[model samples]
Target: MRLTQHDATAPTGMRNNYVVMRPQNLSVGVLPVHDDGSVTLVGQQRFGLMNYSWEMPEGGAPYDEDPIDGVKRELAEEAGLAASHWREALKIELSNSITDQRAMAWVAWGLSAMPIAPDPTEIIRVTRVPFGDLMREIARGSVRDMFTVATTLRAYHMAHQGELPPCLAKAMLASVR
Candidate 1:
């Protein structure tokens, strides 16, 4: 998509009361769970007044990287885990005070948890919790990744219904917690 630019005559940092078109950033997120039904999440690099959220690892899909490749890279770079299989779980467009971008959230199953080697540029702490507690966290507002919530919920729903949408693995991931 073409990102329109303005400043037809505006100063730096000023929108000149014009249409300040925000560039859409395409990104990915992981909703990782283990065989024992435990989920892996993280403490975001940034903290909020409501306390840092427990969200899955996520990142932007680089201009040169395919969505799956970008998500794999993010998984390794952020959560310190890599996967052999990744599925798109849900789609969402998050627009609020903190971010404005299109996101694709995913679920990486048959995972093997190992040491995480996150990029120095990222500040994250990988965490794990029981799958049964997931809903509880959501209810308590502890799990912040909205995409994570959506993906996990959808995953649980699909688990019972058999199979999933073809885009089951292609998702829009986000949340504000």
Candidate 2:
């Protein structure tokens, strides 16, 4: 992350110092759902926070790479899941006021087991939980990552609104009550 200060005029017609963060790459996040309506999450100890966090499989995509491909690689490396179906769930600018980091969120189903191959520096624990349980965890703040929160909520909305495949939406929304 690079931070730069620039001379700018505020909306109020006042001169001000504006600081901006320039991020090098865009990011992608995937919410992986199984046939039974379960979602897979990854637990990892974040070096910045020195605490464990549970979040959807997410990673940075180089400027030249497609975001979907980057997220598919993340899903395989972090969760050991291969998805046959995928949908764009959200597109967001993460902390836009401070940085130019953008992210794409995806919902993936039609899953199959695979071998995980995470980066050597990462130690990730993968878990599959019911969609409802995952929702509760998000509501209770156990899952605090912004990418996960936004993507999961968007998936829930899509499921409720019949934006997903009928069978998949049915399975996903069945546990709501």
Q: Can you give the TM-score per candidate against the true fold?
A: 0.71, 0.96
* Model 2 Cα lDDT, one tens digit per residue, 1-177: 689998999999999998998877788999998888889999999988888999999988888998888899999999999999999999999898777889999999999989999999999999998888889998998999989999999999999898899888887777766
What are the runs in model 1 whose C-alpha is more than 4 Å off? 1-24, 47-51, 96-100, 164-177
Task: Put down candidate 1 lDDT per residue, 39-126, tens digits, no spaces.
Answer: 6787764543545667777777855667888888777777777766666777777764334567788777667656777777656877
Question: Candidate 2 — which residues are off by over 4 angstroms?
Answer: none
TM for candidate 1 is: 0.71
lDDT of 2 at 126: 93
For every candidate structure, what is the RMSD over all alpha carbons to the true structure, in angstroms?
Answer: 7.4, 1.1
